[model samples]
Target: MTTISKTRIDGMPIGLTLALLLACAVNLAVLARWL
Candidate 1:
């Protein structure tokens, strides 16, 4: 996980990127339940 994250653009804040990833996971979970 650490290695993959290291390759991201340095212009973006890590915290914001992590939040987006978390939000995506939450959305996927919600959709999975409905399906």
Candidate 2:
């Protein structure tokens, strides 16, 4: 149980980073289309 929780904690930052990057890419695409 501890190991599983540790792995999940480790994965969270990577997931968050990916989500932020994806959001940034989507925002940039929208801005480009509007401009």
Candidate 3:
């Protein structure tokens, strides 16, 4: 459901936004498991 856009900042690809979001989700999952 995510769309990668051609426009970007400082040459970084827009697709990375989803990757960052997923990384946050994984971090939360690990935190939940630890808690």
| Top TM-score model | 1
Q: Can you write out model 3's per-residue Cα lDDT over 1-35, one digit (the tens) per residue? A: 12333344335755877787789899999999999
Q: What overall lDDT goes with each candidate model? A: 0.82, 0.85, 0.71
User: If both were scored by lDDT, which would come out higher, candidate 1 or candidate 2?
Assistant: 2
Best by lDDT: 2
lDDT of 2 by residue, 1-35 (tens): 99996787577888786787799999999999999
lDDT of 1 by residue, 1-35 (tens): 77666676355788988898899999999999999
Report the number of backbone clashes for model 3: 0
Against the hidden true structure, what lDDT does model 3 obtain? Answer: 0.71
Superposed model 3: Cα runs more than 4 Å off: 1-12
Report each candidate's C-alpha RMSD, comma-separated, in the order given: 3.6, 8.0, 6.0
Model 2 lDDT-worst window of ten = 5-14
Indicate whether candidate 1 or candidate 3 has the larger TM-score: 1
Count of clashes in candidate 2:
0
| CA error at residue 26 for candidate 1, angstroms | 0.2
